[model samples]
Target: MVSRVLVPMDDSETAGRALRYALDVHSDAEITVYHVVGSPSMMMGSAVGLALEDDIETAATERAKPVFDRAHEVAAEYDTEIETQVGLGHPTRAIVARADDYDAIVMGCHGEHSENITRGFLVGNVAKTVFERSPIPVTTVR
Candidate 1:
């Protein structure tokens, strides 16, 4: 039985769909909504700005609050509650590293930053990497 399920999410519609799918398909399992705050880089991206704060961990959590809030709202729709986790660094690595603790992983096929209109592929690098490298079974929701 899948007693624990991990659902990685971003602020994307597909991520929201993936969470709903997990809730519906594994109604009895404990769900964890995981979000990774990418490490700070010279690019000055969102995560980088957050990581530059005095309390990096706290900053990451604060950044992830909205995503978790949305997840909670989604869970409420199913009359269920879900746990949330925040991690730092590469998303694929963070997710795959934690996958061993869960029975299965469910995530969106792609993420908000991965939409490439000019390119043919829609799958995000993180999702593809996690699907290939995860130690447990993975389900991808469109």
Candidate 2:
């Protein structure tokens, strides 16, 4: 019954695991691999430079290429093809905004930069926020 499934991914092993899980569990559903590029920060991070480009949308897409490439590689392991999407701004907000179009959301419990030695929590901010705010069912893979 689930015709559409959304799997948010990044350049992380856990995200790859989540994608594989979705493919195995919902093989019949259309899968969309989404990657969100964080918005520019005042601290002049790489994202800020990317946002300053002539075309911000294109910049975002280019930044997300690595993630999408990995997603495609993973999808190939399952002998399936998946649609890829790139979003800008906060990861949680971007994903939640599109959650309504899918039957469910599947993602990693933490991301590439999720290791917070200061906070002592394993869950990434994006995953935590999405898990809390998503209107649709969310499945988080460790």
Candidate 3:
């Protein structure tokens, strides 16, 4: 039984679809919708722009809040319990680390590949990383 399901969402429509699919398949479970704030290492900033790095990270986290809020609203249709969280680090690693805490993970394999979700993980780097490292079951959505 899937006691909890976690999905790492972006602002993409694919993520929206994945979350919806997760809800339908795992109804009545507690779901955690998470968004990983990109770490400074991922940013290509010059020495001058580095001064605003902290602010940029804060801004990124703040911007993800509303998208997760929408995810919360979407969870209501399935009569599921939902929680939202934001983390800072490599997206795939962070998600996989927490995957063990949840029974399964439901996510969009392709961040933006609308035509092919089957090969989504291969083409999409983050999904590939999570797929390789996830300790639990992974359901990839288009």
Candidate 4:
């Protein structure tokens, strides 16, 4: 029996679907919605900006607010409350690092950037990496 579920959320349709799936299937479990900011990029703009902030944690949380808000709305639809977490650095690494604390992980097969031509036919890089590397069971929702 899974008592703790981690749902990684982004501003994507599939992410919402994943959250819904987790809530519906793990009704008796504690659900936590996680959002990652400052993920590495070729330009490193967001990550660098966050690093420059005096309060990096606060900046990251503020950056993740919109996603967390959407997750809250979804939880409301389920009539359940969920905890929210913010993480810094690479999405895949951050998720994997947190995996040991949960019984399972549920996430979108792809993310907002899946529309990129290069990634159009593949799972989002972060999701794919986490799926492969996470220590706990992972379920991906499309």
Candidate 5:
């Protein structure tokens, strides 16, 4: 009876797998593939030194499109509507706030990052922070 499911991903391999899992398991459900961009204000006072908030948001959306497109392609057999949502703010807060809109929250067990960026679930701060305050069930992928 889960009519809607949200899959928040940075469009990485593991996330791709999670998206695949959702589509395969819940073909009849509506799926929202989401990506969160850290607020420009948060980018400020940080080491990233990325000043182009607008540019980042644009690029992020464009980048996320392909990921969702792939999901759409794979979900063709099912009745799934794949969408790309770009959230501007903290990742966990945005996700938690929107969690109730969907029947469930499905996401990668481990987040996605660049080759140079370190990646791990509980070992990293992103996963840790989300773990501390996730209101819904979170299934972490390996």
Candidate 6:
């Protein structure tokens, strides 16, 4: 009897599929879509803008908009609305840190940038780490 399900999303096809899977499989549960913005980096990245913003929370929200929009579109297909949350720093840590608040976690097998050699090395496998570290059940969709 899972009453709450968390779906961590990125602007990736597999993330979208995980959202759909959660909606279809956990219809009775309250669904929350989470997007993590990279933490402020000295090198090149979106977080550099976050570091400069006077209102860092607002900046993070703005950065998460595209992914959240896609989540909304997916929810629309099921005639449901989803709550959204934004987090800072690494995806795996952000997601796993929040996992205790929900009954389960649903996410993509890997993120959009996981295929990129450079980012893959830098980010590692977010879903794998989240699955291993999460306090709740984790379901991964392809």
* Best candidate (score: lDDT): 1
Cα displacement (angstroms), candidate 3, residue 5, comes to: 0.6
Cα displacement (Å) at residue 103, model 4: 0.5
Worst 10 residues of 1 by lDDT: 115-124
Over all chains combined, what TM-score does candidate 3 have?
Answer: 0.78
lDDT digits (tens) for residues 25-128 of candidate 2: 99999999999888876664568877568888898898999999999988998899999999888889999999999999999988877744324766778888
Ordered list by TM-score, greatest first: 1, 2, 6, 4, 3, 5
Give candidate 5's root-mean-square deviation (CA, Å).
3.8
- In candidate 1, stretches whose alpha carbon ends up further than 4 angstroms from where it belongs are 116-119
Tens-digit lDDT track of model 5 for 1-142 = 8888888877567677778788877778888888776666634443143345457667656655766676677567565568668776677788887777877777765665531376432433454455566766655544
Residue pairs with backbone overlap in model 1: none
Cα deviation of 57 in candidate 3 (Å)? 7.4
Clashing pairs in 5: 109-140, 109-141
Among residues 3 or more apart in sequence or in different chains, the pairs in candidate 6 whose N, CA or C atoms overlap within 3 Å are: none
- Cα lDDT tens digits, model 1, 1-142, are 9999999999988899999999999999999999998987757567668646888888899889999999999999999989999999889999999999999999998887775441367677888899899989999988
Q: Clash pairs of candidate 4? A: none
Q: Which candidate, 1 or 2, would have the higher TM-score against the true structure?
A: 1
TM-score of 4: 0.91
TM-score of each: 0.94, 0.92, 0.78, 0.91, 0.71, 0.91
Candidate 3 — which residues are off by over 4 angstroms? 45-60, 112-123
lDDT of 4: 0.89
Candidate 5: C-alpha lDDT: 0.67
Q: Model 5 off-target regions past 4 Å?
A: 42-50, 53-60, 76-80, 114-128
Say which prediction, candidate 5 or candidate 6, comes out ahead on lDDT: 6
Q: Per-residue CA lDDT of candidate 6, range 1-142, in tens?
A: 9999999998878899999999999999999999999987767476788788888889999999999999998899999989999999988888998988999999988787874543435233888898788899999887
